[model samples]
Target: MVQQRLFGLIFALVCGLLAFGSVNAGTDGVTAKQAQEAEFELGKRLFTKTAVPACALCHTLRDAGSEGAVGPVLDEIKPDADRVSKALRNGLGNMPAFKTLGEAEIKALARYVSQASGGAGPSGN
Candidate 1:
């Protein structure tokens, strides 16, 4: 009987630890999600108005309510995050390089464009 009780105590302790760990894990997940959302919002803002010659001025992204006719329709192209990042960093045909923006800002912009356009592309650094 004593052994059984000890075993039960041990099991209960383990279960409690597991539950505690799960709670912590869940909290971490929530934090990560919130950070991701904030990053996306920043990216959206950059695309719309923050960036010099805002992306909205040339690119049409339905999500941003931009109707720019100069750049290709983002929804149709669905350019990946890498492609967007590269273009933003180095510039494409008519687009000038956004060299002023930091790497983090560039990444945020790339993620936003790719996600908004349904690119499903890999994340940029």
Candidate 2:
């Protein structure tokens, strides 16, 4: 009797583990908040320095102290990470392509823009 109970218990545990493991959920977003934090930090670094032309040189990021009229106004566009990422990686209109920033850097910069643009942070989505 003891052996049978132990076997059943093990089976139940295995089933529970399998059930939990099989469950897949959609990504709300980056798994770690710290990731976005780091990205933001890197972004701030990239934003201020002339790393990529000081985005301010041509675009207005009112909050970021940028007041260039050559590019579109940032606040009005309210560009999200995806849009910014795309723009960075694959430029648009008069914007120059930032293909050299690499995928991660571009993404981080996008997140920075999203936050700096007064939009929701990574925690928002």
Candidate 3:
């Protein structure tokens, strides 16, 4: 009787283990917060990287510590994310369309600029 009970227990444990192992579940990949941080970092790099013209070269942003006089002061303009994104996508006035940047890069840059300029909500509203 004791041997039978021990065998039953072992079988149950093995079955439970197999069931747990066979169950497929999606993994918790990088969180939204992590993705946002990564995007912000990439945006910052794109803004100031040497290979590109660098937004910092023409705009003044406290975060970037850029004091460029050619473009409107980002600190004063404090444009929303949507506004910034549109400008980057289509350009305006003296600014040329940043067609080279990918959509994702442009979005990231807009979010970064808006957030740094005190527009943190969605669409920087």
Clashes of each: 0, 0, 0
Per-candidate RMSD vs. true structure? 16.0, 15.8, 18.0
What is the TM-score of each predicted model, taking all chains together? 0.75, 0.64, 0.71
The CA root-mean-square deviation of candidate 1, after full C-alpha superposition on the true structure, stands at: 16.0
**Comparing 2 and 3 by lDDT, which wins?**
3
Compose the digit string of candidate 1's lDDT tens values, residues 1-125: 34423433543444345446642436544344544575677679889988887999999999999999999999999989999999999999999999877666776788899999999666533
lDDT of 3 by residue, 5-105 (tens): 34335434433444466423334344445556766766676676621478999999999888888999988888888888888888899888887766656
- Give the best candidate by lDDT: 1
**C-alpha lDDT score of every prediction, in listed order:** 0.77, 0.64, 0.69
For candidate 3, the per-residue lDDT at 112 reads: 83
lDDT of 1: 0.77
Candidate 2 matches the true fold with a TM-score of 0.64
**Predicted structure with the largest TM-score when compared to the true one:** 1
TM-score result, candidate 1: 0.75
Worst 10 residues of 2 by lDDT: 23-32
Ranking of all candidate structures by their lDDT, best first: 1, 3, 2
